[model samples]
Structures are given as structure tokens and as C-alpha cells.
Target chain A: MALVGNLRDLKLPNLIQLNCMERNSAKLTIEHAGKYGMIYFHEGQVVHAEFDPDIGEKALFRLLGLPEGKFKVENGVRAPMSTISTHWNNLLLEGLHQLDTMHASGEGKDRRLLEMFMSVKGVRRAAIITREGEIKKGDFQDDKEFALQALSFYEAEKISGLLKKEKSQFITLVTQSKRIILTEYDKDIIYLDIEAKYQLETILPFIEQVLI
Target chain B: MINRWLKEITDIAGVEGVLLVSDNGHIIEKIGTQLDQGTLEQIARRILRIITAHNLDEKSVKEIELICYNYRILAMSAKTFTIITFCGSIRALSLLRITVNVVVGHLIEDKKSMKQIGKYTGQPEIVLEKEYLDQLEIKLISKLQ
Candidate 1:
């Protein structure tokens, strides 16, 4: 039988641990946003893994950064070749270590982007999401991790050409709960956090003023 | 250590190649897809210029990623070496970040790499300064006295 679930509830470590304890030959497929990776277990030991074009420990460390994603394990699936040799415990520890380091310094804040968000009203949370897959938050107050992921999946990758061709400034998201605004800010998307009630027009002038 | 880092970083899905460059335009090491020494020097010069331009901004020179239509470049600076990777296409940020941090960790944590960094920095430079000339002149005068 195959076991599958979201990464939010079952972290990668637990998933790996459970599979290891079961002593099963399996292939664990991890999905985050739209990207996917596979980890192969031979008799409860992680013998090989891949998130191509990454393989082995490099892929493992890269996959560990997905704070939220999905994972499924297929029993009896085998690895084509072994690419990892370290103990699972040591690998997990090292992967987590790399993840923490990347999180701390990967995305850097641009003051102008922060100032633009601060000058606007009803802005709950904001991040300068880059084309290179980084989120530099405007403030420390709100956790917009989910919103950031959705925005990154859609706006950061697909509409990049659209924004540039038209020279458009930003896009607004109005949902039942909140409003998120996106704009071009120095080769990155400005994911502006706004209250649900506030109209897009209300923040337009402030955005134009500060961004200019 | 540099060889191991190059090997690991190239293992990333879209990473095509990596070059460890010294500040004064030396290719300390190159792995994966090969680039001519001229092209490598050009890139190294540009990286040096950009880092120097943004030198004042706190942490501005730490990491620089340039995305283009065909390929991408990601560069991170250590104490003496700048690690640059050529990517097939830009993907999620985490992959690049992980690769960068891991390479930087190797650049710092490895005893051999640290020693190599010192050796790399010890290369001769032609830069001359008035202060150094004055100091040399004074020493000469003292010897004459």
C-alpha cells in the first residue's frame, strides 16, 4: 500500500523515520508547491535520492527546505543507483543545518521596498518575492508564508513577462479573508498585505508615491 | 574542498557549472560546463565591480544572482573566494540558496580550503600606493642614517 499526505502535517523527518522503522523498500515522492522530489529507501535505509537535476545529499538538503509540501511513499519501488552513503540521522541533521543557514541569509531586504509598504495603510504583511525564489519580508509582525507560496507559484513564475511587457506596477488579490497586492519592485514581486475591506484604489496613491 | 563543493553544486537540477574566482581575477577552480579563461576573467571582473559598487550597503555584496532568458548566474562571496554558479534556468530560491550556503560552508569549514584561501590571496598584485612608497623611502633613509 502507498501512504501519502501533505508535508504540513507530516514533516520530512517524521516521514523518513516512519519509513525507516517499517523496514520497507520504497520510493518517497515529495511535492512542494509544484516541484517534486524522490527519495529511495532500500530495506529501511535511504540508499539513493533525487530532486533532479540534483542527486544524493545535495538533493536531500534542497528538499528539506520545503516547510510545506506533500509526500507519498510507494512500497517496493527501487532506486536505479545509490547516491547517498551517510547515516539517515546524520543526513537529516546536515540537511536541516543547511536549510536554517539558507533561510537566515538567502533573501535580503531592500529598504526602499520596506519603506513603500510602511507608507501604505491596511498593509498587514509584505514581502519582496524574487524571480530567483526568495522572499524578503517587509516586517516581522505577520506570518504570510502560505500567501507568499501561492503568490510565488502564480505571479513570480508565470506573469513575469506580462508585467514587463505592459510595464504594469502591481496586481491585487481580494479574497474572503484578506487582500494581497503584487507589483514589480526591482526584479522582484512586491507581495503587499492588506485588510479585506480596503479597496485597491485606497492604497494605489501611496504605492505610487513611495515606489517612485 | 573546492572540488567537493563544485561537485555537489553541479548536482543541483539546473546548475550547469561553477567557478571559484579570486578577487584579482584568478580562476581558483572551475567545474562542470567549461568556460574559456577569457570569459571567466570577464565574469570575475564584473563580479568584482558589482561587489565593490555595492560594498557600502550592509550584506549587499554577500550574494548576487543575475537571471537572464537563456541562463542564470548566482555568486556568493566568502572571505577570499567568490563562488559563481551557472544555472540552466531559475527555479525556486531554495535550491540556489542551499547550494550557495553549502559551498560557503565548505569554503569556511574545511581546514584545507582555509589554507588554500590564504594561498590564493597571497598572489602578487601590481597595485602601488603613495603611502607605501613613502614608507619605503623612510625605511631607506633610516638605513642610510
Candidate 2:
């Protein structure tokens, strides 16, 4: 009988490791997003693979990219052709490395975007916080204190409703020590601490540029 | 006297309402406000908490300006009270700040306002509860009756 289960229960990477370690000759089929991908293992070695329009290493990486799918492994199924020559261990490592690089680039983009804000004159500190209050980018001595600033925005949102006002866009707090600005950025909150010496109006236009 | 002082802020164009809250979250005085007593009280509590949290790090907060889509809310803290004003536009803030300074100055010297503020002095220590901080918005708004 073929081993079958959802990829969610048994991830593709783990499944590949299992088949290769067992030293079994089998063909593993994966169905994801209406597409079918197959990997051929020859006695503990990843000999061949195919995932439509891509075969061998390219197909393997593409398959690894899938977050969820259904997979079936049939024993004694042989590959009609072998296209991958790299060792299975090295292949898996490369695929995972590529995934990590892709994720890091996304985070890097957000960090660079914050750099754009920090570049503004008088912006002493800056951070992007998600709705759950996690700091997505930027740095602060106390993340807890910074996340609490979102409370002001939340209160303002409620107050706006009672006043029958439009949706909230941002909040600016001018304290004795510093001026703090909190604005919405793609569902996340951008917190900026500005020096009291600089007039808020003077730097607002430049800050708005980064927000947009 | 404090009411008259607060009136100067409400008199500004686009200024909707103003609330003078005591240091311990009491509504000492309010002028030209559309919010009911419940909503104002809730806001006062939140303001106190926000100020307290910021001050925990030893940073004294003197003012805060919240800008919504069509409204702006400004909170300014003085020796005795925190003044929260709801306005219709951002432009009103520049004018409000000048007017507020005048009001804060007068309150500091006025014996009557000082005595009234004394009643709420010695603010109780605020315990930062995670549950309270987490439910900042939806819970408070839902409680609005």
C-alpha cells in the first residue's frame, strides 16, 4: 500500500528525508494548487523529479516552496529519466537556503523602508509594529513602551466613532521632552519619535513621503 | 473659572469639545463636549494610563495630538489637570496650543482650580495589567451604551 497524507501533516522536506534515509526506491507524487509534482528516489538517493514546466533541481525547489499539498509515496516505482545529479543533502540545503534568502529579502525591504523614515531630519527613533504589537522593523530600547503607543491610536479610533468621524489615519503626540508620531502603514503602525527642537509642521511633509 | 478658561479652547473654529480631567481620572470640568459622561470618563482613564506608562520610563509627557481622518484630538498635561480636546481639523491645534498655554498658566495661579485639583491629587499607583492593555479598543467601544 502507498503512503498517503496531507503535506500539512508531513511536510515535503521531511517526507523527502524519510524516503531517502530509508534507502527505498519509490516515486513520491504531490498535488498542490491543481498541479502535480513527482520525485523519484533510487535506494536512498534523489535520482529524478518533475513538477510541470520544471524538472530536476528547479522542480524540487518549486515543490519545496509549496506551503501545503497532498502527497503519496508508492514503493518500487522507478524514474523514467534522471535529471538531477547533485547529492540529496546538498540539494535540500540549497533549497532551504534559497527559501531563507527569499524571506530575508522581504524583511530587508521593510528595514530599508524604515531607513527612509529615519533619514528624515529630527526623526530620533522609528519602528513598524504589527497589529499584534510585534515590532516588525526598526529598533528601540524598550519595545513594550513603544508598542503601548498604539493604545492612543485605538482610543482615538473609538472616540472618532462616537463623534461620527471618518476612519483614523495617524496620531501625533507633542510631549514636553519629545514629539511622537504614530501612523498606519499597510495595517501596521509606524511609530516615530522626533526631537522637540524641530517644528512638527516642518518635518511632517518629509515624514509623509516615507509613509506613502 | 476653569470652565471659562476651557471655553477659550472650544471657541476656536473646528474645536468640538474639551475635557479637563483630574490627575486621578476624574472629570473635573468639561465644556462644549458631545460625548456622554461615560465616554469622557473612559477617555480620561485611557489618558491617565497612557501618561503613566510613558512616565514609567521616567519621560514626562506634556502633550499628545491624535489625528484621525476627519478629527484631531489633543491632550495637554499641566500641573493639576490633563486637557483633552476634540477638534474638527488639524489646523485648530496650532491655535489650541496657544490658547491652552494661557489656560494652563491661569489654572496654576488660580486658587480655586488648585483646590479643586487637590481633591484628586496623590494619584493611586497604576498597575500595568496586560489584559487591560490588550483590550484597549474593542472592549471599551463595545461598552459604550
Candidate 3:
């Protein structure tokens, strides 16, 4: 029988434990938003795992951090290879610890940067959004909508990478009524909006100054 | 009128050529110098890539400017058409922008003329300038002698 449930109900560690106790050879898959990951098990021991280009312990750790997702385990599946050697219990503990450390490292810094963006003269809304269109922190009421629409700008950012002679420069989009600026802040992506008439010339220097 | 406007744009001090491409990738009209089919194709492809990457659906795109070392290309939508202009130097930057703005304004607001953007009955015609030059030449020659 396939085990199926939301990751919220059965956390990754608990799911791994369930598989381990049964000594089930299976491939467990989890998906959140648009990203997917797979873990291969040999008789209930995690032998391999992947999330895109990341593999082994790193992939496992990332998968561990997903607070909510849909997960499925197909029993009797073959393990592709052995990439994880750490015992599942110890690995889960370490992964959780690492995620906690990562969150703690970024906690206050991102809020301060968002505050900095909102302090700008023409800025009306400031947000720390992920590449996947998740707004971690925002000053706007419709932050989710803004983040979703601003995700289109990622395509622009990538395209600009191919088009710009100054590859290192950040990308900004100006339309008739609005200016959307994207920049790196506190290891997270910062997105801010200002009126179209506001000068883009002043943004970079101000951001750099505030960052310093 | 678009042909004449194209000429006006190409005549901008350092412009190399003017090409008006439709959203469908068709060249609606072309005027001026030094542009070849291959170069135009490359430019079209580059612009298309930019449009795609920017998530700008055709018809929604209002304007685009691509600046390179030797040249600058400006493209703007005019209903079903997108006008593109290529100029040679950074020296033409201000003039080019102003001219493009004027042309776009004319394209949008004054779609009245078949040969010009609008009907301007009072526009002055000055076809003969040889006499004015002749007076200047005579005065300069007299001073020299």
C-alpha cells in the first residue's frame, strides 16, 4: 500500500521513520509549490535523495525544511545508489538544526532591509520575496498578488543576463505607472515598488548606502 | 506618411537606418542606410528574446531600448506595428529619444495624414535655398578679396 498524506501531518522525519521501521524498499516523493524531490530507500534506510542538481545529504536537508507539501511513497521500488551514510535519526536532527540556524541567521537582517526599502522617498511597498514568488515579508496588503506578478520579472532578470554588457548589474523594470526594482538583500531577494516618475538613477546608490 | 516619418527619423544626425517591424515579425517598412537583412534578423531575434524574457506579451509592449557599443536600437509599439530605429553613436542619444517620442506621439494622436502623421496646412515649404547660399558666398568672397 502507498503511504500518502500532507507533509504537515507527517513531517519528513516521521515519514522517514515510518519507512525505516518497515524496512520498506521504496521511492518517496514530495512536492511543494513547483519544486519536487525524491528519496530512494533500501529496506527503510534512505540510500539516495535528489532535488534538482542537489543530491545526498544536502537534498535531504532541503527536503526536510519544507513545512508543507504532498508526499507519496511507492513501496517495492529499487534504490538507485547509496549517497547518504548518516543514520536517518542523526541526519534528521542535524538537518533540522541546520535549518534552524539558517533561519536564525537571516531573521533580523531581512526585516531591517525591508524597512530600509520602505523608507525611500517614493517607495510605497517593500517585500522580501523568494525566487518562487513567495513573499516572506511585505509591507503591502496584497503581498501575495504582488509577489506572484513580480515573479514574471525573474524571466526579465534572466533575459537581462543574456542581454546586458554589464552582467553584474541588477535588473529593474519600469512601466507606465510603476517601477519594480529587484535586488539582493540579506541573502534574500528584495522587491520594492515606487512611482514611475521616480528616478531609477537614485535607487542603487541609496540601496548601497543603506546596506553599508 | 509613415515612410516620410521614417525618413525624418533616419535623417537624425547620425542614424544608420530605420526599420518598422510588426508584432508578427514582419518588416512593415524600412528607410535609410547601412542595415542588412542578416543584421535586421539578428536584431529582431534579440528583441524577441527580450520580449519573451521580460514576459511582455506582444501588443502589451510599449517600448524597448537596446544600447550597444557602436549602435542603439529603439523599438516601440504602434498598434499592430512596432517601429525600430537604429542610430550609430551615443552622440545621437538625446536627439534620437526626442525624435522617437515625437514620432510615437504623432503615430498615436495624429493618424490623419497618409504622408505625414497629421494635417498641418500652415507648414512652410522651403525648396529653394541656393539663392540664400549665393548671398552668403558673395558676402564672404567680397570680404576675402
Candidate 4:
């Protein structure tokens, strides 16, 4: 029933304590820089969460796994150092994996990629646009065109039209440094740019089978 | 009257075709060039499924439209209907939106006319036979698969 202070001043234990003390439905929204995580408390229990993919009590247990009392609780606000750093590398890998799947499916709509990115812990905003100067999909509406222009270096329209047409579901152009993802489905086109340096060469062939 | 009306719609929208379909995916009237009735029916059914599965409610559903790019599909939806238009990689959203609005208005008018026909005739009994339903179902499923 009480409004807790900013999320940055409290830790996991204090958050749990607040849930029990209030004994009411509450939403804990953590905003660091621009990234956000929302945890839902229902009647003194953690019932839902938006950040930790694990969901429910399992996410609570993960949060509690951190060193006890390591988190500072100030005026009912819990602030843990960099939630992204705590799970940085894992999030990066997941982001890469999502990019891979999107590329493989040739379904790099900015919206779908944004959904995947939002599911991760670190990334705040992102988008994918085809090389043809069109916004495919993304989270923030305004930034979509900017990201597409940045990735394409502003020549997306001309370059995308040059790719060969095929019935393969997806058309990919791969190199040692980066990869281009594109797909045609249900009368629309999607595409993306992905860093190829860290991914296995074998991944492209696998994607071809599933996507194309 | 229906064919003439559909042609008028094509003139307004510059689309290749227009279709009148039932909620269950039956194609009642198909008009336009370079488009087969079967293909239009199949596309309609798939679009309906996409709208339903995504829980994309009416408020957020913009006009029903689809634009094809070289590598992806962009789908737009409206209440009770959808349109799938193919666009090459270079099509702009601004142009697509204008085109779709024209088509949407035509669709609304078409739906009204169909209702008026039923009311005027007093038959009000428009039912696809079981055989036609079965055939449509099979065709739709195969197209999706």
C-alpha cells in the first residue's frame, strides 16, 4: 500500500520485504539509464516479471541468489549495480542468437527484433530495416529510420533492390565480417544486418535449411 | 452490379484485385486481372489467421494492407478484414498507406452492398454447401502448409 522510493536504492531482499509488508498488488519498475525491468508483486508474492525470462518465483530465486545484504535498501528503494553487467555476456549471446534466427528466417522485421531485444536484460533500444530504405521493425518508433540509415550508411534503397530474386524463402549474403538477412513472406519483405565475426560458419547452412 | 463495383474499386485503389470473402474463408466474388480466385481466397484465409493469432485488436489494426519487399513481408490489418499488397524493396510506406486507404473504403462499400442485396431479396439465406466448405477448407489448409 506504500509507495516505495526509487528502484535504484533497494536490493532484492528489501524488494521482497516490501512485497510482504504491503500485502497488495504492486509493480516494481526499474529504470537504469533507459533500460527497464518490471516485477509484479501480488499479495506479498512475486507473481510475474518482465525482464528475467525465467518468470515467476524462479526469477525471484535468481535475484535472491546474489550475495545477501550485498544490495543496499534505502527508503524502500532497491538499487543493485548494473543488472545488465550481472548478466551481460549472457544477454549479448542471446541477442546474437536472436539476430541469427531473424536473419535465417529472413524475417528481420524491426518489430520482431525489437520484441526479442526487449526480452533481454541489457539492450534498451534497437531496430532492423531492409537495405531498401524501409523500416522493417523495431521498438522505438522514431529511432527505426535512424537505425536503418545508420546500418545501411543511407544506401539501403539502391543496394537492396540489386539482390537476386529466388523462391528460397530467404536470401542471404554472407561474408567473414558480416551477414545480410532477407526474406519474402505473405507479400512483404524483411531484412537485417548481423555481425558475422563471432558466429560459426556452420550456422548459415543450418539457417538455410530451416528458413529457405 | 458486384463485378462493376469491384472494377470501380480497382480503379480507385490501383490494386490488381478485390475479393469478397466470408469469415470462414469462402470467396464469394473475385474481380480484377492477373489474380486467380483460388489464390485470392487462400491469401484472405491466411491473413485472417494472422490477425486472429496475433491478438491484434481493432484499435491498433491499421488499414488492412501488405507490402512485399525483396526479403520480408509487412502486413497491416483493419477491423474484420486485411489486405496484402506486394511491394518491391523500394516501395514507400507513405504511398502504401494512401493506396490501402482507397482499397479499404471500397471494401466497406462492397460489404454494405452485399448486405443490401440480402435484405432486398428477402432470401437472407446465403450458405455455402457442405461440399464447397470442405473444398475451401482443403484448399486453404494446403495453401497455408
lDDT of residue A1 for candidate 2 = 100
Clashing residue pairs for model 1: A53-B12, A53-B13, A54-B13, A133-B93
Clashing pairs in 3: A23-A43, B1-B114, B1-B115
Candidate 4 structure quality by residue, lDDT tens digits, B93-120: 4554555566556656776655633333
Please report, in order, the local distance difference test score of every candidate based on alpha carbons.
0.62, 0.75, 0.60, 0.41
Q: Write the per-residue lDDT of candidate 3 for residues A1-212, one digit (tens) a residue.
A: 88889998989888998889888889999975435789988866789998754789988876777666789999988867889988877888898887767667666456545544544556667787765555788755553334333443433343344434332234455444556666655445667776666665456556555555
Candidate 1 per-residue lDDT, tens place, A1-212, comes to 78989888989888887888888789999864334689999888888887745789987776666555678999999899999988887888888876666556634236434533543556666676654335555555322333333332332233234213333345443333555566666666676767666765566666665565
Give the winner by lDDT: 2
Off by over 4 Å in 2: A1-104, A131-133, A161-164, B90-92, B124-145
Candidate 3 total steric clashes: 3
Q: At residue A10, what lDDT does model 1 achieve?
A: 88
> What's the CA RMSD for each of the models?
21.3, 16.6, 20.1, 17.0
Off by over 4 Å in 3: A1-104, A141-164, A168-172, A183-189, A202-212, B1-19, B25-75, B83-96, B109-145
Interface RMSD (Å), each candidate? Answer: 20.2, 5.9, 21.6, 15.8
Candidate 1 deviates by what RMSD?
A: 21.3
- Tell me the tens digit of each residue's lDDT in model 3 across B37-79: 7556545544443333233222134555543435555666544
TM-score of chain A of 4: 0.30
Clashes of each: 4, 0, 3, 27
- How far in Å is the alpha carbon of A61 misplaced in model 4? 26
- How close to the true structure is residue B63 of candidate 3, measured as C-alpha lDDT? 59
